[model samples]
Target chain A: SQQGEEDPQALSIQEGENATMNCSYKTSINNLQWYRQNSGRGLVHLILIRSNEREKHSGRLRVTLDTSKKSSSLLITASRAADTASYFCATVWNNDMRFGAGTRLTVKP
Target chain B: GAGVSQSPSNKVTEKGKDVELRCDPISGHTALYWYRQRLGQGLEFLIYFQGNSAPDKSGLPSDRFSAERTGESVSTLTIQRTQQEDSAVYLCASSLTSGSFSYEQYFGPGTRLTVT
Candidate 1:
C-alpha cells in the first residue's frame, strides 16, 4: 500500500496566482519532500521539511508539515507558466520512501 | 557534476523475455534506489543500496525482480520472464545517504520499458 496520498489530483490556475496542494500519509515520517516532473521526465527535488520543523521556504515555494495529522501542504506563490508540471509528495520512514499519486498543476499564461 | 543517468531511454521486449535496465549514479553518491511508475500511478519503491551495506530488497514486487550495484557506481535491475503488466518507467535515484534524514535524491531520466 502507498503511504502518501495527495488531494486534488489535478489543479489549474492562471499565472501570477497561488496554487496549493495537500498530501496525507498513513505513518510516521522522518521527513517529507516535494518533487516536480515535467511530462515523462524524471522528478526534480523541490523542498524538504523535517518532522521537527513546521514550515520551510524556498524561493516562492512554501511547505508546511503537521506530524500530528500526518499531512503536508505545498504552496507555490506567483505561479508561472513554467510551473506547469506534476507535483508529488514523498514521505520517508526510516530508510524507505514512498510517493503519492501526485497533483498535476497547469499554470495558464 | 553530471547527474544520474540511465541507459536505453526506451526498451520494448516481448513477453517471457528477460530485460535489464541500468543506472549510473552521480559521482561519489553512496545511496542508490530503484522505482517503478505505472501509467497514471504513483512511483513505487523497488530497492535500495547504500555503500557496502546489504541492500534493502523488501520493496521488490516478486522474486523475478532483482538488482545489483557494484562498488557504489553502476546498478542494474533484471527482470526474468517479463509480463505485459510489467510495462512502466523504471527510475533511478541517488542520495548522499540512505536514511530518510539525509539530503534529497537526484533522479535520472529513467528507462521506459514496454513488455508486449
Candidate 2:
C-alpha cells in the first residue's frame, strides 16, 4: 500500500512559471523527505521536513508540512527546463520509509 | 565522495531464471536499503539493513526475494525465480545512520531488470 498520494498526477508549466505538487499520507511520521528523479536516473534528495516543522525552504524549493492534516506540499518557484522531472514524497516512521506514486512535471522551454 | 554505486546498469533475464543485483554503499555509512520501482510508479520499499542487526524483511514480496549485506558495505538482492512482474528497476540507498531522526539516504543508479 502506498503511504502517500500526490495530486495532479502530471503537470505542465512554462519555464518561468511556478509549479506546485501536493502529497497526503495516512499515518504519523517522524519526518518527510522530498526527492526528484530525472528521466532514467536515480532519485535525489531535495528537502526533509521533520514532523515538528511547519515549513522549510532550500534555494527555490519550498516545502510545508501539516502534520495535523497529514499532508505536505512542494513548491518550485521560478521553474526552469532543468526542473523537468518526477517528484516524490516519502514518509519515515520507526526507521521505515514509504513513498508515494509521485508527480511528473514538465517545464516547457 | 563517490556516493553509492551499483553494477550492470541494465539486466535482462528470462522467467523462472535467477538474477542477482548488487549495491555498494558510501564508505563509513552504516545503513543500507533496497527498493523496487515498477514502470511509472513510485518506489516500493523492499528491505533495510542497519549495521549488523537483523534486516527488516517485512516489505519483501515473497520467499523468493532475499538480500544480504556484507557488514555495512556491500549488499546483494537475489530473486530465485524471476517472474514477468519482477521486471523493474531495483534501487539501493545508504544512510549515515539509522537511529533517531537523521535518516537522509543516498541512492545509486538503479539496475533495470527486464524479465521476459
Candidate 3:
C-alpha cells in the first residue's frame, strides 16, 4: 500500500523556471527520498533527507523534511527540459519503504 | 563495479502460464528488492531480501506470487498461473546493506511483463 500522496499531481512550466512538489506521509520515518522517472524507464534516485536533517541540496535539487507535519517538499531550480519526468517521494522506516503516486512535471523547452 | 541487472527485459505470456524473472544484484550488495509498477502508477513493493535472512513477502498481492534468492547473488520472482492483472513492469533494486541509514538503492532497467 502507498504511504502518502503527492500534491499538484501534474505541473507544466517553461524552461528556466523553478518547479516545486510536495509530499505528505503518515507515521514516522527514518528518512525521505526523492526519485525521478522518465517515461517507460526505471527510477533515478535524486536526494535523501534524514529525519534529523531539515534540508539538503544536490545540484539544482533541494529537499526539505518536516517531521512534525509528516511532510516534505522537493524543489527543482532552473528547470530544464531534461527535468521533465515523474517525481516520487518515498518514506523509509526501518527496512520497509513506501512511495506515493508522484508528481508529473513537464518543462516546455 | 557493475550495477544491478535483470534478464529477459520483455516477456509476453498467456494467462495461466507461469513466468520467472531474474535479477542479479550489484556485487557484494546484500539487499535486493522487487517492485511492480503499472502504467502511470507508483511502484508497488513486492518483496525484499537481505543477506541470508528470510525474505519479506508482505506486499505480494496473491499466493501465486513467489520469489527465491540464491544466497545473496541472484533472485527470481515467479508468478504462478499468471493473470492479466499481473501485467506490469517488474523492477529490481539492491542496496549496499539493509540498514535504515543513508544507503541509496540502485535499480535495473526492469522487466516489462505482458500477460495476454
DockQ preference between candidates 1 and 3, better one: 3
Candidate 1, after superposition: displacement of residue B50 in Å? 1.8
TM-score-based ranking: 3, 2, 1
Q: lDDT, candidate 3, residue B22?
A: 97
lDDT of predicted model 3: 0.91
Alpha carbon lDDT at B64, candidate 1: 93
Write the candidate numbers in order of decreasing lDDT.
Answer: 1, 2, 3
Q: Which residue runs of candidate 2 sit more than 4 Å off their true CA positions?
A: none
DockQ of every candidate structure: 0.69, 0.70, 0.74
* Cα-based TM-score, every candidate: 0.95, 0.96, 0.97
Residue A25 CA error for candidate 1 (Å)? Answer: 1.1
Candidate 1 per-residue lDDT, tens place, B6-77, comes to 998999999999999999999999989999998877788899998899999988999999999998999999
Tens-place lDDT digits, model 2, residues A1-109: 5698888899999999999999999998999999999875689999999999999999999999999999999999999999999999989888778889999999999
**Cα lDDT tens digits for candidate 1, A20-95:** 9999998989999999998767999999899999999999999999999999999999999999999999998887
TM-score of chain A, all candidates: 0.98, 0.97, 0.98
Q: What is the DockQ of candidate 2?
A: 0.70
